[model samples]
Structure formats: C-alpha cells, structure tokens
Target: MKKAISLLGWIGVIFTIIALVLTLLTTYHFTYVKYFNDYYTLQWSIFGTMMIWAANMMVFRTNFKNIVYPITCVIIACATMFFMYMKVY
Candidate 1:
C-alpha cells in the first residue's frame, strides 16, 4: 500500500522540480545578469519546500515520532542543494 501525500507535499515536489530546472538552465546556457549562479536559489527553494511540509506536519499531524516524511523531504532538499553546489562551478 502506498501512502498518500498531502496537497502541500505535491506543492513541495513541484517547487523542487522547478528549482532544479532553473538551476540546470541557468548553469548551462544563459546566465542571469544580476545573480552569479542559481544553485543558491535552488538550495533555498528546496529548503523552503522542506519548511513548508514541516509546518504542515506540525499543524495538521503533529507526530514527531513519525518523522519519515519530513526528514526525507529535508534530506532530498539538502542533498539536491548540495549536489548543485558541488556539481556547479
């Protein structure tokens, strides 16, 4: 049986996807004039999504013991962020 993800989780997934895409695009091709790179932005977006899911869990579920979801989110976010950081430049 598959666990159902909430609306906020879906949103977080979407945000992560967009962040990765933007980072890839900015890194390979056209660089935005104002910013040096998009990795920081990617990292922040991932972190933001993780935060959003965390808040959702706290307000709705409030189960600290059942932390698999939130921790997974944070790890994926931070890992992707760091991957971008290491892969880029």
Candidate 2:
C-alpha cells in the first residue's frame, strides 16, 4: 500500500508536468477564455503552482525527502509566482 501511494505521487508529478507542457503549448490558442489571454505569463506561473498542488496530494511512505519534496515544491512555486507578480524582470 505504501508503494502504491508512492507510485501515486510519482504519477501526480508526471501528470503535472504533462499539464504544464500542454498549458504552455496551447495557452495562446485559448480564445474562448479571455482571462487566459489577459493573464498569459501569469498563467504560466500558475501552472507551476498547480504542479505543486497536485504533488501535495501525495500520500507516500514515511520518509523525510518524500514529505519535503512536495512542500518545498509548493514553496518554490509560490515564491516564483510572487516574484513574477512583482514584475521582476
């Protein structure tokens, strides 16, 4: 059961990557969603957060790295989005 849960975490990570890629590839084509067009780059950073969000749902074995990984990802994602929001270019 622990292995299965671990597998779920990995699967979530894979799907998150896939979602981010697909979002990047098709974000320009989202003519139906005005918000998406208006928030193009903002959406990209959102995809990063979403990746971590999915990762946070993980229920893996009792390991430090396994636990910290998702939380750390979330923190990084939030920091990135925050910096991006600040228009740090």
RMSD of 1: 6.3
Off by over 4 Å in 2: 30-89
Model 2 lDDT per residue over 1-89, tens place: 65665565566567556555555555667434333333444545454555545454455326665766666667767776776677652
How close is every model to the real structure, measured as TM-score?
0.52, 0.39
Cα shift from native, residue 89, model 1 (Å): 7.8
Q: Give the TM-score of candidate 2.
A: 0.39
Positional deviation of residue 3's Cα in model 2 after best superposition, in angstroms: 0.4
Q: Which ranges in model 1 have alpha carbons more than 4 Å from their true place?
A: 1-12, 30-36, 62-64, 71-89
Best by TM-score: 1
Model 1, 1-89: lDDT tens per residue?
A: 01233576677779778777767777777654334255676676677777677656655655667677767766776776677768743
Q: What is the lDDT of residue 29 in candidate 1?
A: 76
Give the clash count for model 1. Answer: 0
Error of 1 at 74 (Å): 5.0
